[model samples]
Target: MQVKHGFIGFGNLAKAVYQGLKEEEEIEFAYFARSRKEADIPYYGRMEDLTAFADVIWLMVKPQDLSAVLEQLKTCDRAGKTIVSPAAGRNIAFIERYLGKEQLVVRIMPNLAMAYRKSVTAFATNQPENENATEIFGLLGKLGKAVQLEENGFDLFTAVFGSGPAFILSFIQIFKEKMQEFNLPGPLLDELLLELTQGTTLYFAQNQKKHSIEELIRNITSKGGTTQAGLDYFRTHEIGKHFEGILDAARKRSEEMSKNGD
Candidate 1:
């Protein structure tokens, strides 16, 4: 039997997940939009109508946009329907209060890397709700890694992994530009950087040899070597401390939003 799903917002993340699920023959999906024919998926003119066909409904709107959506949804009974939200700040209780006690709700935070099936997604839910738990896990399992975490941890995870990919990609691009500054050929630079980053990750995964990341760095930075010189430069420039502050600020903002973004 095909597992069908629907999305409330036809945004980039929604479209990406739709594409990923479409690749698998057993999952059928669609979305709701203002216009009926804007996207390839079947669109519903009204919010209540989407629940009719899909067992799972993904709420993919902005945090601020959620209130109006909820206002429309308030008139509908979502019993037996599983709703998954990817909004970074909203908690499951907030959703349940608005939707109803009988509704099955799960909150998730997924990064843009989900486009490539590399997302590290965190799901927070009342696990005692067996049906919703299974539905959420089964649906998200297709896109990438799904971790069940306490609600308190979701906000922090979003700051690190959900928003971390963009930060990492920006750093990668900065290095790529630095390679160009050295007059390296563009395609060769791209190829080298791609392999360089992937190889770094591969080293961790392939080596069953467990070592702390700091230990691994120390192992590479033997006394008076090139790695040591680079490490010294980074430390001297205070880049490591600056990054710690950056991540902390991001985490704080996520926490604040969760508290007030209703």
Candidate 2:
């Protein structure tokens, strides 16, 4: 039998998964949204209706929004049901505190790549040794990589991998602008950048060879080459330091939000 899935908030990530599983042969869902339009699937206006239909619920609301949703959820029956939270900064303990001790909760940090059904999601359940953890992991495995992590490790994952795509895109945008600044023709520049990134990514995926990524960079860089010239320019401008500062700020904000943080 297909498991009944439910969502508390119907945001982008929720919609991504909904679209991914909506036509699946073994999955079905109904969701809860503030307004009917907010949900991509059939939705109920009342939490009670959603609660009764769901065997596993995905909580997608903001950290601040969690409290009110918890209050409302407390009025419904949650025993034996699994509650999965994909919100950043919130943890299993917080869910247990707000929902109840009996709630079977899991926390995940799935990147936006899930929109394309390709995500590297980090998952952590409240109890590391729980028997049901395997079942939970298997279910999520269909969506993408579902690596089980210690709950404490979630924060670190959030700071790094969860926010990694944005960081990479920021760098890519700078590279794009640099191409324009050099008066490279637009179409040719676009093609070069696209192949530069896509081919490099494909090469790494195919090889998975013995060397570390830094070692791979060393292999490509020759003495006084164009790549070395660009590397020198970034080094001179303290690009590494700038990246550290950017990630540090992201990590700090995540910490703040986890503790009643916005």
| lDDT by residue for model 1 (179-214), tens | 776898889898998998998898776663788788
**Which 10-residue window in model 1 sums to the lowest lDDT?**
124-133
The Cα error of candidate 1 at residue 147, in Å, is 1.3
Shift in Å, residue 61, candidate 2? 1.0
Which residue pairs collide in model 1, if any?
none
lDDT of 1 at 214: 82
Give candidate 1's TM-score. 0.90
C-alpha lDDT score of every prediction, in listed order:
0.80, 0.81
lDDT (10s digit) by residue, model 2, range 1-262: 7788898988877888887667777677888988876554678889999999998888878778987898889889987888888888988888888787667788888877776667778888875566555666776676777788877677777877789888988888788997777897888887888898999898787666876887777778999999899889889999899898888888888888887656
Residue 87, candidate 2: alpha-carbon lDDT = 84
Model 2 poorest ten-residue lDDT run: 127-136
Model 1 regions lying over 4 Å from their true place: 36-38, 184-188
**Residue 121 in model 1: shift from native, Å?**
1.2
